[model samples]
Structure formats: structure tokens, C-alpha cells
Target: MADILTVNGGSPLVGDLEVRGAKNLVSKAMVAALLAEGPCRLRNVPEISDVKIVSGLLELHGVKIDSTDRDGELLLDPTNVEQAHVADIDAHAGSSRVPVLLCGPLLHRLGEAFIPDLGGCRIGERPINYHLDVLRQFGADVQKRPEGLRLTAPDGLKGTRIQLPYPSVGATEQVLLTAVRAQGVTELRNAAVEPEILDLIAVLQKMGAIISVETDRVIKIEGVDRLGGYDHRAIPDRIEAGSWACAALATRGDVYVRGAQQLAMMPFLNVFRKIGGDFDVDDEGIRFWHAGGTLNSLVLETDVHPGFMTDWQQPLVVALTQTTGLSIVHETVYENRLGFTEALGEMGAVVQLYRECLGGSPCRFGRANFRHSAVISGPTPLRGAEITVPDLRGGFSYLIAALAAEGQSKVHGIELIYRGYERFSEKLDALGADYQVG
Candidate 1:
């Protein structure tokens, strides 16, 4: 049975909250540890469901993971890792993308890898075709089986130049993992340049991998003979930081998001400023609050890294309900992302989803009746209602919607929130949010 969250609305959340490591980075970093010869120590890890999934997967491969650190530090000993049992690996195939990332490192170490199916946000079809194609480019023989994907690098990995049709984050990580141990130089074009990717590269460099980033979205990696383990700290989660910032805005409260860098979120920070949100930034973290003034509507489009993130759109839309005008949001990432707006509409939000490409390019969700564009008519007062979370970011948006609403709200399927946010309930309580687990 799914866990439910009951939130009593009409209370302003105000306090300082700390954010741990990036969920996106930590998962990939855990998989990256498989490439190291010695044990690697990771600090500032978030105690989330996805991290546990990756840890379990690593233990199945004979890697020793000691996660008893009270401070969220993890010691991963991959030196003794053996061929992982396919059946055990297949169990969590649909959990997250971290499993697919294991294919590369495992293939390099053992010359054969069996990867279960991959799963993540249901925004669109997250195909591993790009990942497979990149693996094949590196001279790995790939075959599809009913159980999972089987990959073999009999002659060992040989690097080659490959270009991605789209800058997919998972595919980019797959290439980085596979190419670092390849025989020669690997050139990857259209690579994702997100901060998480950069952090992964920093970790890889510290582990003796030679990698360089070039203009025109190119990443070149000269495969090293062997990689030594290195201790590293994961980057702060920008999505989690942004979620709390939106929460503060939605509740008309004050919150200091500690441990997150402001420069990493320039696009969101710019929009927050345009929306009349006040903030103060220091070396430690950022503080967010709604200034006593009319909130303005600004145009937003979700794109790949450096673009307005698609993940941040949903919660920001919830905050936009209080803004006194028509706010236009064009989602360029996933077509079906607007589905969350339906639940918002049920909570008294004046949001309209449209199928006609309001922005121009044909989106994956546009072919069906799924709308990619949203027009939020606001200064509409929202009333709380029962809602089910559709995905990770959508769940947090529901929390923001509940906080902004007038009556009590029951948010079902809240367990999905652990995929991203860490210490969410305790942090919410610290902010004076009246929420209880059910």
C-alpha cells in the first residue's frame, strides 16, 4: 500500500532548511565507483530511496558498501566486485536509471554485463537506445534478451567518436562511464553539460581519468589503463533546492536553503527575481521569501541543462497561481508533463493545457492529446483537495499546492517524493508546515 501524507493548509512555512547532495549526481557517482580499483568514500550523501536502490545493486555485485556513517558518508569497496547475478540485478531494473549506468563499468571490469530495464520520471519515453548505441560505438556487442540487456566487450572497450541525436542526461553518463576505461580517445558530441555531469567529471578526474570539455558541446575522454579510487563530495541538489524555494514562495514564507549554490540556478533565480521574490545569497546558501508586492508572470520554457529545467516547472506553476496575471509556460522537454496541471485544476487553479504547439517544435506528448503548453490565469485562490502524486517533481508541487490552498489536503502516493527530496517531512515540520504521515 502506498503511504499518504495529510497536510493542514493555511500555515506559512518559515525557517532555515539544509539540502544534501544531488540525487542525480549521487546515483551516478555510486555507479562510477564501480570503475575504481580501491574503495572510494563519498560524503554528503542523501538518505533517499534511490540511493538505497543503488547501494543494494552494488552489494549484489560483490562490492562492499559500508553506509553506517551518521553524517551521510558512504564507503564503497568495489575492488572485490565480481560478476553480478542477473536475476538479482533485474529486480530493480525498473527502479531508476542508475542500473543502466552500471552496465558500462561492469562490462569494462568483467567483460560481460546484464542490465535490467531502466525507470525514472514518467515525463516521456526514456529510451536506452542512445546508451546502447554509444556502447556499440565503443566496440561492445549488445543483444536484447527478454530478461535484460546483455553486453560483452570481449576484445575490451575501444573508444570511437559518437554524436548524440539529443543531449540525453542518462546517455551522457553512460558514455562517460564506458569511455573512461576504453582503449583510446572517445569524443562525445552533444553531451549534457549540466552541473551534475561536471561534478561527475571532477570525481572521474580525481580518480586518474583524463577528460576534457570543449566548446560546441563536445567531451573528449582518453581512456586510462587503470583508475584509482578517490574521495569526493557530491554537488548540492539544485532540483531539491529549487523545490524548497518554490515551497517558500507558495506558502508566502521565508526559507534559507543552505548548502545550495545560487549561481547553479541562474535561470530559476532570474525568474524568481522577475516574479518579485526576494532572496539573499552568501557563501553558505540562499534565502527565499515573497516580498510584499504584486507577483508578476513571466514566460518560462523547460529545456536541457542551462535551459529552464523541466523538473522545476511544476512547482513553479503552483507558486504562479498566486501571481495576479496570465502566466505562460511552454514545456519543451516532455509533452505529457502538463498532466500535473490537471490535479492543480482540481485544486481551484485556472490552468489550461493545450495540444497545439504554443512554442513551435513538435514534442513527444504533442502527438497524442497531451498538452505541452500551459496558461495559468491567476490570482486565483486555491482550495485544498485530495491529490495523488504522479512523479517526483509533481509530488513536491502537490505539497506546494497544499500549502498554498485554503483547506486541509490529503496527498497520496507521497512515497515517490523520496526519489528526490531528502529529510522532506522533518524539513517541512522545521518550516512550521502542519503535515503528518498516514
Candidate 2:
């Protein structure tokens, strides 16, 4: 039977809950474990579907991982890394984009690698072309196979100068993971300096990698012949922290998110304050709550790091539904992110989509037909509605909406929420949300 969540609405979520390692960084760190000569120990790992997917993929390639500990530590040993059958790879990689990242390390360790059909959130055309081009630039031979893509380092990978059209996080990770063990030096321009990317760099550096970050989005990596194992703690999930903060604002509740770092969430914090959400940050976590007043509507734009993140847009949109006046949101990161707002509209949010950028300067999607912008006129009441979970962020936003509504709401396909959120149902229960899962 499909998973369903029955949410009882009109309640404030008030309590303390903990957030573990980042879903974005933990998977990549698991992949980075494959590059080390010995076993790598990663701490504070989150219990999410993406981590399981990557664990299965690594196990298929003969990487032995021990994650039996309850304290969220993973000990990954890649001593017996060997080629696995493509069929097994496809089955284990089912609808995950993490396999694409395994190409460079596999090629370096085994002279060849195979990546099955990639799958992830249906937000935009996240083409693997940028990843493939980076691999090709690093002297990898790419060939299309029936099941998936096959990459071979016939001449042994060599580092080279490259530039990104946009600072894509995945492509930046590809360059970092690939160039670390390649020959000579690699200079990358227009790189993504997201906190997750920096955390990955830290993991690699612990494994004896030489990497330097410069001003204006430039990253330089000096290749080493070999790398040792690393022991590191992954960063907290800023996205998850922000999501819960927005939930507090939407339902006029108070929430304390443990392990949420203030530095990584500074941009989100600024925006939260502007929208009339109050937060107190300590060394351990941040406490978010509604300020018990009218929320101020404002123009917002979603960009890469140091900007209002695209991942934070959805939940904030739910909070914006209760704010006075109009709130304009320009999503510059993903083109189809605003589509999730349709369910919000069905639940009585006055949201309008636009093809042209309405809140900020013209982005890459402004001239296109994609509805990447949103205008939400709120102080509107939300009622219960039947909804299906979309992507990870969208799924959590739906939960916030349901909790803020006046009646009962049944959310189906809620298993998608587990892909990124770690034990969120339990967290909801801790927050005193009246809900049952079956």
C-alpha cells in the first residue's frame, strides 16, 4: 500500500527537534569515501533515502560500509573496490543522480565506470551534460551504452582549466572529486562555493587533497598521486532548518531546531526576520517562532549560495500566504519550482505564476516560457485539501500548508519526503502536530 499521512490542521508546531548532517553533503561524502586508500569514517550522517541509495551503489561496487551504529556514523572501506555488473548498478541506482558522481573515482580506481539512467526531483532539466563535459575535460573517454553511460580513463585522467556557464553545485562537485587525484593542476572558474561544496572539499582535504578557494568564485586544486582515508563530521542541513523555521511562521508556532548552524543559514535568517519571524541562535541550534504580528510582504529572489536559496522558497511561500499585501518570488535556480504552488492555490492561496521575472532582475528563465516567478497575495485563509507529495522541498511545504489549514488533509505519496527529510514524521510529532501516518 502507498504511504499516506492524515494531518489535523490549525495547530502551532512548538518544540525542540534535532537536525543531523546535510542530505546534500552526506551522499557526496559517502561517494568521496570511494576515493580514499583506506576506510573513511563520517560522523553525524542523516537517515535519509538518498544516503541509502548511495550506500547501495557503493556496496554494489565492492565498497564495504558499516552504518549499524545508532549515533549516525558511517565507516566505509573501499579496499576491495571492483567493477560490478551494469544490471546490478541500474537496479541499485534506481532513479538517483548520485551515480553520475561515481564516474571519476571509478575510472581512477578501476580504469572504467558505468552510470545508469539518472533520476532526481523533476524541478528542471538538470542535464548531466555539464558533468560529462567536466569528465571529458579531465581526459575521460565517454561512450553511450544501452543501459547507461560508460566512462573510461584510457590515458589516465589529467587536470585541465575549465569554466562553468553557471555555478552548478553538482558540476562543481564533479570537478572537485575528479581533479583531486588527476595529474598536474586544475583551475576552475565560476565554481559553486555552497556550504555543502566546501564541506566536500574539507572531506577531500582530510584525505590529503590540496585545494584552495579564491575570490570571485574560483577554485584551484593541486592533484596528488594518492589519498589516504579521512575522519570528519558533516555539516548540518541548513535547508531542513529553514523549512522548520518557515513552518513555525506559517502556523504561528515556535520551533527549536537543534544542530542548525547560524552561519550557513544567515541569508535565510535575514529573510525570515524581514517576514516577521523571530529567531534566537545559540551554539547548539536556533529557535524560530512567529512574532505575533502582521508579516511584512517583500520581494525575494532565489539564487545560488549567499542568496535566498531555491530550496527555501517553497516553505517560505507557505508562510507568505499569511502575510499582508503581495509577496513576489523570483526563482532563478530551477525553472519549474513554482509548479508546486498549484496545490497551494487549490488550498486557497492567491498565487499567480509568471513567465517573465516579476520580483528581481531578468534571470536565465525570464525569456523562456517557464513559470519561474510567483506573486502571492495573502492574508488568505487556507482550508484542508487532498494533495500529493511532489519533490522533497515541495512535500515539506505541503505539510506546512496542511498544518496551517482549518480541517483535515490527506497527503499521499509522502514517502518522497523521506528522500531528503530525516525522520520528519517523528519531528512533526515532537512539534505537537496532530498527525497520523499509515
Candidate 3:
């Protein structure tokens, strides 16, 4: 049976919620522990299902995971890392594509890595072609079988220069994780410089991997002989922090998000303030609220770091439903992202999806037949409705929509939301959100 969230709308989600390490970074960081020569310690980890998924995957590969005395900390000992059984890996893989990342690190240690067929959310087609291509460049032989893929480094992995057509985060991480222990220098052009990626680099650096980032999105890595485990705290989840801020704006409530860093969220903060929302940033975190006025409609675009994040678009779109005039959002990251707006339209929001890129710039999806842009006409009052969650980010947006709606909303498939948001139900309860799980 699908888990349904019954949300009583019209009440503002108020009060304080704490965010932990990033969902994007923590999982990949856990995967990186496999490359370590010694025990590793990661701090500020979030208690999300992805962490558990990665933890189980690591244990299957014989990495010992233990808890530390400090809260939100994990000790990963990869000293006895071994190849996991194919059947065992397939059973414990869950729905994350993180196992694909095991190719590089496992190859370095065990000389061969077995990758199960990857799975993720239904947001868009995230082909592992980029990852496979990167692995091939590193001299790993890829063999496709009925079960999954088997990658063996017969001549040992070696680094080579490659340029990404697009700066895909997964692809970039694949290169980093693989290239760190490869035999030679690796130069990657058009690399993704997201904060999560940088934090992973920081972890890798502490593990004795030498990586340098150029201003023009080029990253150079000098392959190390071996990598020691790192003692590092993962970055805060900017996506989660921004989602809560948007929830505050959508419900016209005040929210103080602890552990939300200001520097990483500057683009979101700028956009929030521009929409007539208010925020105050301190050493601890940020407080978000409506500015007690009609929210202004604005044209926004989602890009890589230093621009509005694609993950931040969905929830903010919910807030735009209450804004005056029209708001245009161009989603450049994922082509199928605007598909989530249909649920909003059902709830009385005037959100229209367009194949043409509606923001100031034309994106890769402009020529393709995908609805990558959305035009929102609002000050439209939302009514109660039943909505099924599409993906992680989109699922959170549904909750924000339900909270902002006039009556009640039955949100089905809420289990997907737990893949990203940490302690979300309890956080909603702390904010006085009227929601119950069934």
C-alpha cells in the first residue's frame, strides 16, 4: 500500500527546523570511504534513507560502519574492503545509483568491480553513459551481462584528459572517485563545481588526493599512490534548507533553519528577497518569512552553482502560486522537471508548462521536445486535492502546496520524499504543520 500524507491546509508552517549534511554530498562521501586506506570519520550526516542505503551497500562490500560519540557522526572503516557478492549486492541495492560509483574505488582495491543495474527517481533520463565513458577513459574494461555490468582493470586504471559535453554532477563525481588513485594525471574540462562536489573534493584532499579547480570549470587531479581515510564534516544541505525557506514563504510563516549556511544559499536568498520574502542570516543559520506584502513575480533560471539550483525550483514554484503577476522559471538541469506542475494545476494553480525555454536564456531543452519551462499566473487560491508525488524534489513541493492550500490535500507516495528530506514529518510537526501519515 502507498503511504499517504493527509495534510490539513491553511495553517502556516512556523518555527524552527534543523538541517544536517547534504543529501547530495553525504551519500557520495560514504561511497568515497571505499577509496580510503584507513578508517574514515564523517560528521554532520543526515538521517535520511539514502544514508542507510549507502550504509548497507558499503557493509555488503565489507566496510565496517560504526557510530561515534558525537551526534550525527559516522565512523567508516574500509581496511577490510572486499568485493560484495553479485546476488547480495543486487538484493541490497535499493533504488540509488550509488553502486555505480563503486566501480572506481573497488577497481583500485579489489582489481574488479561488479555494478548492478542502476536505479533512481523518475525525474528524467539519467543515463550512466557519462559514467561508463569516464570509466573507459580510465582504462577500466566494461562488460555488460544479463545481471549487470562487470568492470575489470586488466592493465590497471590510468588517468586521461576528457571533456564533458555538460557538467553533470554524477559524471564529475565518477571522474573524481576514479581518477584519485589512477596511475597518471587527469584533466577534466567543464566539470561541475557545485558546493557538494567541492565538499567531496575537500574530503578527497584530506585523504591525500591532489585536485585543483580552475576558474573555467576545469579540474586537474594528480593521481595518488594510495588514499588514506578522511576526517571531514559534510556540507549542509542547501537544497533542503532552500526547500524549507520556500515552505515558509508559501505558507506565509516564519521559519528559522539551523545549520543552513548563508554563503552557499546566496542565490536562493537573493531570489527569496526579490520575491518580497524576508530573511536574516547569522553565524548559526537563516530565518525565512514573508515580508507581509504581495509576493512579486520574477523570472528565474536554474543552473549549476552560483545560479538558482534546479532542486530549489519546485517548492519556490508553489510559493509563486500566491504571487502577484506572472513568474517564469526555466529549468535547465533536468528536462522533465516541469512535469511536476500538473499536480499544482489540479490544486487551482495557474502553472503552464512550455517546451520553449521561458527564462532570459535558451537552454539545451529548448530544441528538444521537453517541457523545461513554466509560466505561473497567480494570486490563485489553492484548493484541496489528491496529488501523487513524482520525484524527491517534486514530492516536497507537493507538501508545500498542501500546506498552502485552502482545505485538505491527500498526498500519496510520500515515501519518495524520505529519500532526501531528513526527519521531515517531525520537522513539519515542529513547525505546527497539520499533517498525518496513513
Clash pairs for candidate 2: none
lDDT of candidates 1 onward, in order: 0.88, 0.93, 0.92
TM-score-wise, the better of 1 and 2 is 2
Candidate order (TM-score) = 2, 3, 1
Candidate 1 lDDT (Cα, whole model)? 0.88
**Clashes per candidate, residues 3 or more apart or on different chains:** 0, 0, 0
* Every model's TM-score: 0.97, 0.99, 0.98
* RMSD to truth, every model: 1.5, 1.0, 1.3
Q: Per lDDT, what order, best first?
A: 2, 3, 1
Give the best candidate by TM-score.
2
Q: Model 3 residue 169 lDDT?
A: 95
The list of candidate 2 runs beyond 4 A from truth reads none
Model 1 TM-score? 0.97
